[model samples]
Structure formats: C-alpha cells, structure tokens
Target: MSQPQPDPEAPVLRAEGLYAAYDGTQVLCDVNLSVGVGAMLGIIGPNGSGKSTLLRCFAGTLKPTAGRVLLFDTDVATIPVRQRARLVAVVPQHTTTSFAFTVWDTVAMGRHAHLGLMQALTERDIRAVSSALEQTDCIHLADRLITELSGGELQRVIIARALAQEPQVLLLDEPTSHLDINHQLDIAALLGALNADRRLTVLWVTHDLNLASEFCERIVLLSNGHVAADGDPLEVITQRQLAAVYNTELTVMTNPLSGRPQVVITASKNEARR
Candidate 1:
C-alpha cells in the first residue's frame, strides 16, 4: 500500500501572543491569529486599534516586541526577504514611489522574487503581469503613468502588482480607502474569485465592519491594541460590542440582501455644554 500523503497546504500564517510597539509605546497587545490556506480573514477596528501595525507584523516589516509570527510553521524572521516576498505579497495603504515609473513597470516589479538579479523578464512573468492587470480591471490603465492615475486607478494598479507576485498569501491595508462603491465591490468580488480559483490566503484591514462581514469568512476586531472579539461576524459585531469598542451608538442588523451583519453608526444626541 502506498503511504498516506501529508496535506501540503496548511495554515500559512500564524501570530502567537503578538505584542508590538513603535518608539517604545505598545500598539498591539497579546494578539493571536492565524490564516489557513485559501482563507480570507478580515481585521476591523476603530482608529488607533493597531490594525495596520498587525499587518506590518504579519508582512515581516515590523518586529514584534513580544511573541512570534510564523510563516508555514516557520519563524518569519528565519525566512529570507526574497523568499518571504515570494510567499507573501502586500498592497499597502500608501503606495508612493519616488520615481515616476509606468504602471506596467510597477506591476512587473512584483515578479522580482521569481527572477534572479540582472535576469530578464520571463514569458511567465509577462503572462502573470498581464493576468494581474486584467483581474484588477486595470489593463486599460497599464500604459498610464503612476502619478497620472486617479486614487482608485492607482489602488487597482498596486493590487495588480501584488497579484503579479503570484503569492500564496496576500495582504491589503485599507484597500478601499479611496475607491468608489463600484470599485470597492469590484475589488471585493475579485478577492473572492482569486481565493476560490487560486487558493490565496488573504488578510485585509478595514474600518468598515459591514464590508468585513460581507467579504470575510472570519473577523478579528481590535480595540486599543487588543483583540476585543474574534469569531463569526454575526456573533462578534453586536450592538453592545460596537458601542464599547467604538464609543458610538450603532445598530447591528442583518443586511437585507446578503443576510450578513450590518452596522450603522448613530450620532450621539448629548449636547455640548459651555
């Protein structure tokens, strides 16, 4: 009888007891999370919740003051920069390059991990870059200058660049920040399609809990440097929890269309005193 084969794809990213800080001030505390292959995990929180910091830690850009981040069960610190880039790709909130590179050039740069230094672009790289641009619906803007594109166009280009990496895991920090509703839905649909077709593990940060609930299978809600809630969107995004974490009155209800948890913030009624 043939020996049983081990499951090759498992949890690709794990954060254990992660405590992070900047300039000696702690921003994240004892946060633990994991992303299995093909999973899309959404991170949501109010401002100052350290969601961006958490993404940085997972991307290996920021070292945790405490705890560890593991990639494929290996310490991320042990992974070389190039190898890590191949395994994980990031679409940061602000993607501003000093030089004025064309969109094609920027997108093709994602293939750097697969190419040796001083090597020419392979046919595979060209195909991947083209596919990425098409997936992000930015193929028409391919020849446009990076600085000439609008916010949404530029964001899609950056996302295409990350997709060109052909990474097993993808990370996006506030991907919908400057996008319109149409582009936001477009990107969300693209992410789902990519995960289903390519088995990409995604960890995305969002301030909009409704979008998080609609797009992700699981969510991690952070508040003041700690995970206040971690579970299904319906269970975790209750009115009480939202009030406590965000310091605002919110109505939590099932979305009529998607049947997912929908959060609506209500402005405070208390009047200011002289």
Candidate 2:
C-alpha cells in the first residue's frame, strides 16, 4: 500500500461541541475530540457514560444533537453512505444474529458498499476478503460456519470483515468482551500492529484500561456526560481519575516492561474486613 498522507494537516476526525442523548437524557456533553491520521485513541468510561453513543455519531448511526463532526474537514452528514463506508468501518461488541453463512460469505458482505445488489464477488473483492482473513489469521476458518465458531474465532472474523472494507478509520466497541486473557492479548497485538504497519487510524472503546494503555497513543476518559480527561495514557489513567469515574478505589501502577499504566481495583473496606 502507498504511504498514508502525513498528519501535519487537519485531523481525519474532529468533534467540536458535540452533544448526544437518548430519551431526552443527555449522554455526551459538549465533547471535543480530534484524531489525526494513523492515531490510536482509546475511549473508556463507566457504564452509560456514552462511549458507544459517541462512536455511533462517528459511524453515522446516531446523529449528534449539536456541534459538528468533520471527516477530512467536511461535514460527516454530507458524505454519501457508500463513501463513508469506504472511509470508516465499525467492529461491534458482539453479533448475535444467527446466520448459517460460511465465514468467507460473511466477510464478503463488507464489500456490499462497493458492489451492486446482485453483483458477484469480483477478483478484487475476493482478494480483499482473503487478505483480511490472512491478516487476522482466520484464513483456515474461511469455510467454517459462523454459528459453529467460538466467540473469539467469530470476533476475529468480524474484525477481518471490517478490514475487508479497506477503511482508513476503524472503530471497535468492546472488542474483547467475550474473549479470554490470551485472546484479549492477541487482539490487542493485532490492533497495535495494524496501526503501526498499515497506518490505520483507530478509535477503540474498551473496558480493559490496561490493554488500552498498552496499545493506544492517547485515551479519552468520559464521565457523567463529559470528557473527564484526555491525554497520553499514562497521563490520563491516574488512580484519582479512575476512582472518581468508576466510583471505586483503585491502585495505578506502571508496567515495567511496557512502561504503560496498569490499574488494580481495590476492594471495598467492608469486603476487606471480612
């Protein structure tokens, strides 16, 4: 692939005074964020803090109540859906719909934005799907049924499908929710590699703060419908900030190997008394 354009210019994504809510309840409050080309940004917050809600705005699934979302300095709403699909892909937390399609067929669906309703998979599309499977190390499961695979296997397939979109921006929501520790590490490694090698600009919402700190260049912490903090992972994942947002006591330490922040949840005094 050709070298991605430099980041000296405007950011690939910018949110200014963004506000979003549900059922007349505000979820995000005047959020301002900017993501440069090839940047890896992690979004973390307590439940109902609107990490997913903010992502929906960028994915064009949820319209913002106020403010502007610019893709390449152009309004996101003005971009055609097909054009937007080519620019961004979302890997959801989990997919529960039962479809008996083979893994290859499921992944090929990512190309729909580029093909007619009745169009067959062209050579380019096939190559793209195959390459995505290879990148995620799921090529061996290409012929397997989606319903028959384990959660981790299916997660990789979904990520592969997103990759097949050949998107410049990748948005992942709770990608490791159903995975074990090993799978979590594997997926984190893959994401880090993709960002480093392919220059894929990534926005990830994860509950795993340690993984986020290890893999992301920066992190945005949300709480009570506002951005509580935004900065380098080490700078943002402090014990005070986490305790306040998560409503729990926690110890923050630095990983000696990676030099990233690590969080250890502290037990409540009542529990400790036991």
Candidate 3:
C-alpha cells in the first residue's frame, strides 16, 4: 500500500484554539501554532507549562477539550490510528519494557503500521529498518537487547524506530534530557542532520534553553498554559522573556560560533543564604 502524501500548501502541523486538561484541571488553553514543512521548532517553558501537553495533542495521543489539531490539513483526531502513526512519530522522554526485545525487533516494530495483518517484513521493510539503524548509528547494536544499551545508545535506537516509521513530522519530548553533555551534542547533531537532509518537520519539547536556541530554527515559549512568545530563538529566548516565565535572574548571550542565544543563570539574592 502507498503512503498518503501531505498537502503541499498546508502547514505540516497546526493547532488551532487548542485546549486540553487532565482530569478537571486545564493544562493548555487557546494554543495556536503552525509549523511549515521541514521546520525545526522547539517548545520551551518551565515545568507544568503545557509543553508536553501540547505535544501530546499534536501526536494524537491526547484529545483536546476544545479546538483541534490538524496534520496535513486533515483533523488529526479523524485520522486512523495506523495511518496517523505513519505520518507523525513521537519519541518520548522515557521508554521501558519488561520483555527482552532485540534492538532490531524493537525498531522493526515501527513497520507494524505499514504491514498487513500477519504480513511478514518484505524486502522493503528490511531496507527501511536497516536504513533507520544506520541513520541512528545503531546498526552494530541491532542484535543487542534493548535493556543492555546505555542511555545514549538506547535513545538513538528509539529514534531509529521512529525513523523506520518514515514519519513526515517527528515530535520529541526532551530527547536529550538526562543525557551527558557529549551525548546531548550527539543527539542534537543527529537531529539537525535529519531535519536538514531529509526535510523532516521536527518539533520537540525541551527545557534546555541553550539546546533549543542553538538547534531549533524557531522557539515557542509557553507560560501558564498560554503561548507567551513564539518566533526566532533570539526573539523568544530573550533575557526579559525568559526571566519573566522562568521567574529567575538569567542572561541571554549570543553564541560566537552559532550566533544563537545562550542562556546563563545568574545568582539570585537568595543565593547568599547558601
């Protein structure tokens, strides 16, 4: 079966008047955003700012209380689950499995959406899985158990699974969180290459201001369930904007190499107590 092509004229992903809640408490409100093809967008905010909530709505894992999410100009909620998986892939912050699955088996599960009932992996499927592993630099670990891999290696394998799905829009919720500096850079570089080379529409929720500023083409800052700011990194990640939202003293400096904003936390008056 052939995959559905996205409408060229419409934004790859869009949220209009999106509102979501957990139980009775609202998390996101009146959120409106549009992501064009191949754009790398970072969703940044303090804890409980609805960044993950919004991403969940876009990924169609959560439905909004009001308004809607659109993928390829079609309402995301209306898309079939299997079809949706083919278009939008999400890499979550954490993944755990009690069963021991090989890296290859885990990644190949991404092809489940494309395969017919009881259908075996065809040559095309094998190629896609191999390509995903190679792209994520985890082909050598294909035979290894997922539980045996390190944090960085496992993160790469998870990404390889998403790539195997051949999604047009990739949504990551803090893909680099908890990773060391070197691994963080590796993930960032890999994401950059995928966005540039494959033109994948990438949107990720991250708390690392510097990482978002350095890598994302645009940043959307959310505060108290509302969009506080949205624009280029320099525009959204300003000292004033971040200080107000984060409720802290900080400085935003221009990185000499990337010409992007780098966040620096300054000592607060309370620091004297320490």
Where is model 2 more than 4 Å wrong at Cα?
Answer: 1-8, 268-274
Clashing pairs in 2: none
Clash counts per candidate, in order, are 0, 0, 0
Off by over 4 Å in 3: 1-9, 268-274
Q: Judged by lDDT relative to the true structure, which candidate is superior, 1 or 2? A: 2
What are the C-alpha RMSDs, in order, of all predicted structures?
4.6, 3.1, 4.4
lDDT agreement with native, every candidate: 0.87, 0.90, 0.92
Q: After superposition, how far is residue 137 of candidate 1 from its true place, in Å?
A: 1.6
**Candidate 1 lDDT trough over 10 residues, lowest sum:** 1-10
lDDT of 3 by residue, 172-234 (tens): 999999899999999998998999899899998998999998888889999999999998888
Q: What's the lDDT of the predicted structure labeled candidate 1? A: 0.87
| Best candidate according to lDDT | 3
Q: 267, model 3: CA deviation in Å?
A: 3.2
Q: Give the clashing residue pairs of candidate 3, or none.
A: none
Best by TM-score: 3
